[model samples]
Target: MEIRHNELIQMYPIGYVHNIFKEAIFDEKMYSSVSHIVLKEEFQDGLKDITDFSKIYVLFYFDRSEGYNLIQKRRYDGKIAGVFASRSPRRPNSIGLTLVELLEVKGNMLTVRGLDAIDGTPVLDIKPFIENDMAGDDLRSA
Candidate 1:
């Protein structure tokens, strides 16, 4: 498939995140915090059977992030790495993927633990985290 570098793509948020965090904070507290993913009324029905999974992948948008650096020092370990290699919010697409623990599901709201996104953050999608689906070290060969 030929990729179009200038192509413009658009997406709508399926839900919004609710948490105590008002902005991005790089710390252990942010990753160990609890948050809620509230889906729109129209998308509420899609949560059926989702409770079967203990963990989920939350795809969100970094609405506040402006620009990105190609190479920078990592937050935790001062090791320098490329944008793709580091979990930086500032990126070309500003898309974030976090694997959070699913705590409870009530109505259109999902209580999750360890979501780094701040309150009112737009959620693009959510998917179950399957252990068998993890590529892990196998991805190095691919």
Candidate 2:
């Protein structure tokens, strides 16, 4: 299939992140803090058996991130790198992904830790973190 560069894709948020931090904070403290992923009432049934996994991947949208820099200095090392090489919120598509520890699941709310996303961040999806899953292996190796 030929992919169109100008094609647009639409997605509805399954939930939103809730935390103490109101703004983006690029620091260790932000990732270490606890956060909540509150799913919509209609999506509540999807949370069933989610607690079986200790860790999960939180895919969210950076709604507040306005623009992107194809090439920029790394936040931590200060070395230059491409946008795709670093975890900068500024990207062609302002999408953020973080692996957070699943602490608890109560009703439609999920208590998690190590989530760097700020409060009210729209959560795109959630997936279990399977360490042994080879699905993440390099495509060249396939």
- The TM-scores of all predictions, comma-separated, are 0.90, 0.91
**Tens digits of lDDT, candidate 2, 1-142:** 9978888899999999999989876667877789999999999999889987899999999998989999999887888999999999999989999999999999999999999998899999998877666666733342
Per-prediction count of colliding residue pairs?
0, 0
Candidate 2 global TM-score? 0.91
lDDT per residue (tens digit) for residues 21-70 in model 1:
98676667877889999999999999999998999999999999999999
Candidate 2 regions exceeding 4 Å error are: 135-142
Total clashes for model 1:
0
Candidate 1 has its poorest 10 consecutive residues by lDDT at 133-142
RMSD, one per candidate, in order = 3.9, 3.3
